[model samples]
Target: MNLESLLLNNLHRFPPRVVAWIEKRLKAIPSIRQKIDKEYDDMMGGLESSLKPYKDRFPAFTELPAQGRDRAEILREMEAMQSQEEDRWREGMVSGAVYHGDQAHIDFLNRVYALHSQSNPLHADVWPSATKFEAEIVRMTANMLGGGADVVGTVSSGGTESILLAMKTYRDWGRAKGIRKPEMILPVTA
Candidate 1:
């Protein structure tokens, strides 16, 4: 049998403690560890190509140029890059992307972003406008979801950060309740 099938069969038969011990032993072997690392690197390399198609085509800078690039040149470059990347989504060739992106909606959002570009919600004392916007967004979402007036919400950067914050909250709540260890339930398909 292949090593993977053997490991799978053994894992099914072993208890948690025994499985952990086996895992430790397997990782302790230099060849096995090196093989795992190499496999991970190879997998990431394959993913990187699809993730960053422009990495090879565009000019990359490690440091700022002595003289700043012209504003018109920068705008032209941005437009070129945007056109190249937007076609797939615009034509509905990409999955789970915007259904449509009209010039009016795009222009309005761009203007709004530009107007508030300098505002930092993190520094709420200095940028109360940003904080107010965040609060209103949370309130609207809570209301739309049938949440009561007392319901509170906060914004997160993204899904992974939101999950991490929830996990941390669970850990703390469990500790407060005298539970030494807490378990997080994750979907197998997630």
Candidate 2:
């Protein structure tokens, strides 16, 4: 089977430990490593063309321009791209994106983003606004998910990061409880 199919098959069958073990063994052999690397590169190259359908529509950034252009010209080009791309999302043709699509709503959000564009949460002391946004976001989400009684959580980026954080927490808990090399069993499905 192809490498992608093999990876997906193993992912479906085994937990992370077994998969990592298998990957380690396969990469230990030079020939197997080379074969898998070549297959992965070929797969990625074939997928790139389909993934980057807008490469031709926008600048591909092959090389930097020798000279800088006027800010108005650059903004005009970007506006054109934004207008061209907005129609699909605004019409709800794509999935799970552009929940707020009205022009007024979009413009309001863009203005808010521009206002807070320089803010970074990592430096919460300098960007106290980011801290406020984070707290409000967490509060709103918690209330939406039935948070009146005992639910409490900090804001995280998304599901995968949250899962990884929880997994690490549990792993540390298990280690503290004197479990050696603690492994988790995840079920396999057809």
Best by lDDT: 1
- lDDT for position 163 in model 2: 82
* 49-159: candidate 2 lDDT, tens digit per residue: 767766777676668878877799889878987787778776778875556667799789999999988988899899998888888877888899878745556777676
- Runs off by more than 4 Å, candidate 1: 1-4, 9-17, 20-38, 91-103, 123-126
What local distance difference test score does each model get? 0.85, 0.81
Where is model 2 more than 4 Å wrong at Cα? 1-46, 62-66, 147-190
lDDT of 1 at 176: 95
The true-versus-predicted C-alpha distance at residue 69 of model 2, in Å, is 3.7
Clashing pairs in 2: none
Clashes within 3 Å, all models in order: 0, 0
What lDDT is reached at residue 37 by model 2?
93
lDDT minimum window of 10 residues, candidate 1: 91-100
lDDT of 1 at 13: 80
lDDT of 1 at 58: 66
